[model samples]
Target: MHIPDGYLSPQTAGGLWALMVPVWYAAGYKVKKTLSARQAPLVAIAAAFSFVIMMFNLPLPGGTTGHAVGGTIIAIIIGPWAAVIAISVSLTIQALFFGDGGILALGANCFNIGFVLPVTGYYTYRLLSRGAAEDSPRRWFAAGIGAYVGLNLAALITAVEFGLQGDLFKAADGSALYSPYGLSTAIPAMMIPHMAVVGVIEAVMTSLIFVFLLRNNPSLLHSYDGIRAAATGRLQLKPLLIGMALLLVCVPLGLLATGSAWGEWGAEEIQADVGYVPQGMDRYLGRWSGILPDYAFPAAEEADTGEEPAGAVSLEGVKESVPGYMVSGVVGLALVGGLAWFSTRLLTRRSRKKEQLD
Candidate 1:
């Protein structure tokens, strides 16, 4: 869940930011000690995968939408420490470029989707598949189950954050200062769709990719049973790259999703829903409008005509958006993946340096 700006009070957002700075540092140090030079670039691919997979939105029960985060899969392939950096790269790009999430809420978003999902999934897989052979079915499918668990857990944590905002913060008349949804509404609204639909897609996607790589290019993955790493074959990047290209082509499919995600409604939406926009949201929302707002090209203002009718979908808007969505996917992939590659490459290089005192 991409928590927009103003959804949480400044205190909550700042607290999460404080929590993540050290976690991000620790993740980098751990990855530096373990990630080899050859393995670093694959983190880029995994980061790009995380970026693109998030574009495919599936409808939820309450008219909201959800999508799979490839966090668990990335963790499985490159360890949770590296997965943190990889997925963080994707989330940062989405927030900064696409306005998918708020700038102030970036830390909270990363903590939930980037940190919690991967670490939980990675450890869960390790626990379930412990002592199992590399090729064993239990080990093979354990990642899928881990992904399911991890996705739901992340979703629940997001719900709690949204839920708490309403209860803890209020205006003079007791209207919500931030999000209007308390635990009673936020919990069910966010959890039902995630548990039923989104988790299945996450599990299946993770397992199928795991199965394929384990069979064909096991070396691409972080040592599962210490067997895949020692296997004879490695370096089959073509198929994976091809798959990425295919995903970019289909990224526009995300637009089919009809509604904003739960708790992610904008100021206008909040006004319509609750008859008043939360004062905090009115203040801090849209502090940073992204370069490509909503993954669409800025529409050319019509010839002095008044704004189009509310809720009206124009054919031209669709045509313009599809290409913009496709371009946004490419831009996101390049930016996210490039940052991952460079950062990890620098870390890996630093790890290899020997201090020689003259």
Candidate 2:
């Protein structure tokens, strides 16, 4: 669930950022200590994988849309700390370039999906997958359940954040100044779909990936100390690369979803639904229109002169925008992948230098 800019009060956004800054630093410290030369690129691949998976939106109940964040699988394969790095990278790129999430709210988004999702799943899997053999079915089962739990928990937290905004921050007229949905409305609106549908999709995705890795390269699972490199050959990138390439090509399928997510409605939609825009939210709306807003290249000219927005999601819009969407997917993949790699390289290199000095 990507919270758009206007959905959150600046106080909420800033508080989340203050909490996240130390978490981010600690993630780097942990990843640098644990990430080996061979493991560095794995984080990059995981970041790109997470980014692309998030593009494939699924239709949720109440006419809203949602997607599977692959944070749990990344945590399983690497570690929760590295998952933070990988997921944060993916989310930052999406917010800055594609307008998937808000630039100001990136920290809050990362807190929900990047940190909470991975850490929840990682610990859940660890608790259940403990003492299971490298190739055990129990482990993957644990991973699936962990994913379901993690995704739902993250969604619940997101709902709470949006819910609190309505009550905590308000105009003099007693209208909400940010998100208009209070706890009762926001929680059910978010939780019902996630619990019924989105969480299941996330669990299935994680289980399948974990199964694939188990069959192909069990050693890639960092938490499994029993299956070290002594038994396995060099980590194979070709299979993972092929899978990501195919997903990139098919990203346009995400346009098939019909509605925006619950907390991601635009200003006009907010006005129509609630009778007015919040004062604070109005000021922050479209605070930063991303380069490739909503993952499409701007048309040379407006595609239409009609009631709906030119970039509105429809069958015709999907048909027209497929090429741009695919290109955007490719661009996102490269940016997240490269930036993730660079982050690992920088952190690991710094750790190495410190060791040399010692």
On lDDT, the leading prediction is 2
Off by over 4 Å in 2: 226-233, 305-314, 350-358
Per-residue alpha-carbon lDDT of candidate 1 for residues 1-358, written as tens digits (9 for 90 to 100): 9999999999999999999999999999988877765565688999999999999888787677889998887898889999999999999999999999989999999999999999999889889988888888887689999899899999999999999998899999999999888899888888888888999889998999889988987766675532235323345668889989999998988877767888888888899988999899889998887998777766632222444464444555555568778888989899998999998888877543431211
Q: Write the per-residue lDDT of candidate 2 for residues 259-293, one digit (tens) a residue.
A: 78888988998999889999989988888868888
Alpha-carbon RMSD, each predicted model: 3.3, 2.8
- Of candidate 1, the 10-residue stretch with the lowest lDDT total is 225-234
User: What TM-score would candidate 1 get against the native?
Assistant: 0.92
Compute each candidate's TM-score over C-alphas. 0.92, 0.94
- Candidate 2: 10-residue stretch with minimal lDDT: 225-234
Error of 2 at 108 (Å): 0.3
